[model samples]
Target: MDMEYLKQFSLDGKVALVTGAAYGIGFAIAKAYAKAGAKIAFNCRGEKHMEEALAAYKAEGIEAKGYYCDVTKEDEVQKMVADIEKELGTIDILVNNAGIIKRIPMLEMSAEDFRQVVDIDLNAPFIVSKAVIPGMLKKGHGKIINICSMMSELGRETVSAYAAAKGGLKMLTRNICSEYGNANIQCNGIGPGYIATPQTAPLRTPGHPFNEFILAKTPANRWGTTEDLEGPAIFLASDASNFVNGHILYVDGGILAYIGKQP
Candidate 1:
C-alpha cells in the first residue's frame, strides 16, 4: 500500500464536535480524534459534568473545548453549534453521542420515560445533525457519526425504550446519508457492543453471571473497551471513509456474528 494511502486516516486541521462527551465512549472517541490531530469540542448538559470532563481531558493533555447544552433541546443545540462555529470553525465532524436508556420492561415502561429515551437517543441526533449540516454544507464537506447501540439490530429484555430509540437512530443514520450524500456529507453510525465502562462495572465483576454470559456469547470471549472503539470512530471521522456513508459499524467483539456457545 502507498504510504500516502495511510495518511488519509489523519484528521489534521479538522474540528470535531462530540456531544455528551463528558466520559465513556464519547470521551474515548474525542481522545482518538485529538490524537489524530483534530481539535476537539464536546458538550454536556450540566456544569458539573462539563467540569469533570474538562479535567479529564486536561489530565490527558488534550485541550478540548467544552460546552454546556442539553442536546435534546433544539434551541440549545442550535446555540451550541453556533458557539462552536464562532469559537472553532464550521464543524467538519459531528459525533452525536448523547443518549439515555430506561431499562424498564415494555409493559412497565411509562410513556413519559419512553419519550425521554427517544428524545435523547434518537431525536437529539436529528436536532444536532440538523443544526450542523448547514455549516457543513457551506464548508462543502462533513462527517456525522451517530452513536448507535446493538439494540439497533437486536432486542433485549428490560430495555424496550432503548431498543426503540436505537432502532429509530439506525434508520435516521441511513436517512441522513440518503439526504446529504450528494452534498459530500457522510452520515453513519457506530453500534457499540457491551463495553466495560464504569457504568457497567457492577455487571463486569469476575464470576458475575452477566459477565460470563457476555464472554460466552462473544466470539472474542471478552467485553469491549473504549479503546477498542477508538480506531473505528477515527476511521468514520476521517477522510478515509468519505465514500463509506449510511453504514453502521458494530464494534461488538463478534457478539452479533456469533450465535452463542452451543447449549
Candidate 2:
C-alpha cells in the first residue's frame, strides 16, 4: 500500500464539531476524530451532560470543548458555531449526530409528539449545517455527516414519526450535496442498524423477541457497535471521501440487505 495514499485518511489539525456528542454514537465518533488528530468540539443541551462529557474526554486524555446549545434552535446553533470558530478555528467537519426518536403508533401519536421528533431529528440538522457551511466555504473544503437510521429506508410499527423524520433527513443530506458539492463540501449520512446501546439494552437482552428478530434479520447475526461506525465516519469526514457525496453508508450489520431465513 502506498503510504502517500493513506495520508488522505488523516484528520490532523482539523476542527470537528460533532453535535449531541455527550455520549453514545456521537461520543464514539468524536473520540475517533480526536484519535485521528482532529480538535473536538461537541454540544449538549444540558449542563450536566456537558460536564460529564468533558470529564469523559479528559479520562481518555483528549482535550475536547463542550458547549451548551439546543441544536433545534437556529440562533443557539449559530452562536455555538461562531464560538467554535473562534476557539478551535474553522470547522472542517460536522456530524449532525444530535437527534431523538419517539416510538408510537401513528394513530395514537399526537401532533405534538410528531413535531417534537421532527424538530430534533430532521430540522436541527438543517439549522446546524446552515450555520457551518459559510465557514466551510471560506476554508475551501468541508464534510457534513448526518446520523440517519434504518428507519430512513424501512418503516416498522410504532415508529411512524421516526421513519418520517429520518426519511426527510436522507433527502436533506442529498439536497445539501447538490447545493454545496461545487464548493467542495461533501454531505452524506450514516444509517445505523440495531446497536447495543443503553437505550436499546432491554431489547438486546438475551431471549428478547426483538433481539431475536434483529439477529434473524441481520446477516451478521449480531448487533452493531458504536465502534463499527467510526471508520465510515472518519472516511466521510476526511480527504479520502472528497468525491463521495450525497451517499448514505449503512453500518447495519447487513440488516438492510438480508431478507432473513424462512420461518
Candidate 3:
C-alpha cells in the first residue's frame, strides 16, 4: 500500500473519547484507536467499571485514561469532557458508544423503561455531542461516531424501546452531519449486526433457535466479532473518511441486504 494512503488512516497525536468502553464493542474500538496511535480515553458509569477498564487497558500495554461519567447526564458529561481536555487533550474523536436496551414488548413495557432506553441511547449521544462540538469547532476538525444498531434501520420482537431509540439516533447522526459538515466535522454511525460477545454467548449456542435464525439471516453464515468493527470505526474516526458524513456503515455481513433463503 502507498505510504500516503496508509498515512491518511494514522491517528497519531489525536485524542479519542469512547463512552461505555469498559468492555465489549466499545473497548474493542478504543483498543483499535490506541493501536493506530491515538490517545485512548473512556468513560463508564461507575467506579468498578472504570477500575476494570483501566486494568484491561494496562494489561494490553495501553495507557488509557478512564473516567466515571454518566453520559446521560449533561452536567456529568460536560465535567468529564472538561477533565479529558485538561488531562489528555481536546477530543478529536468522540464515539457515542454508551447505551442500554430493555428487551420488552411494546405493550408490556412500562413508560419509565422506555424513557430510560431513549435517555441513554438517543439523548445521551446528543448531550455528549453537544458538549464536544464547540471544542471541535475551535480546533477546525472532528469526528463523531455514533454506535447505532441494526435496530436503527429495522424492528424486531421484544425490542420496541431499543428500536425507537436507535431509530432516533440514526436521524440524529444525519442531522449532526448536516449541521456541521461544512465546518469540517464529520458525524456518522455504525450499525452492527448480531455480534458474538459475552453478553450474547447464551443465544449463540449451536442448535439454539435464535442462533440458527441469526446464522440463516446473515449471509456471512456467522455472527460478527468485535474485531470486525475495528477497521470501520478507525476509518470513520480518521482523516480517511473526512468526506464520509451522515452515513451509517452497517457492518452486518450483508444481513440487511439479503432476504434470506427459503425454508
| Regions of candidate 3 where Cα sits further than 4 Å from its true position | none
Using all chains and alpha carbons, the TM-scores for the candidates as numbered come to 0.98, 0.98, 0.99
> For residues 59-116, what per-residue lDDT tens digits would candidate 3 score against the true structure?
9999999888888888999999999999999999999998988988889999999999
* Runs with alpha carbons beyond 4 Å of true place in candidate 1: 1-3
- The TM-score that candidate 2 achieves is 0.98
- The true-structure Cα RMSD of candidate 2 reads 1.0
Q: Model 3, residue 27: displacement in angstroms? A: 0.1
How many angstroms is residue 8 displaced in model 1 relative to the true structure, after the best TM-score fit?
A: 0.3
Question: lDDT rank, highest first?
Answer: 3, 2, 1
The worst-scoring run of ten residues by lDDT in candidate 1 lies at 100-109
lDDT of 2: 0.94
Candidate 2 lDDT over residue span 77-177, tens digit each: 99999999999999999999999888788999999999999999999999999999999999899999999999999999999889999999999999999
The runs of at least 3 residues in candidate 2 whose Cα sits more than 4 Å from the true structure, single-residue gaps closed, are none
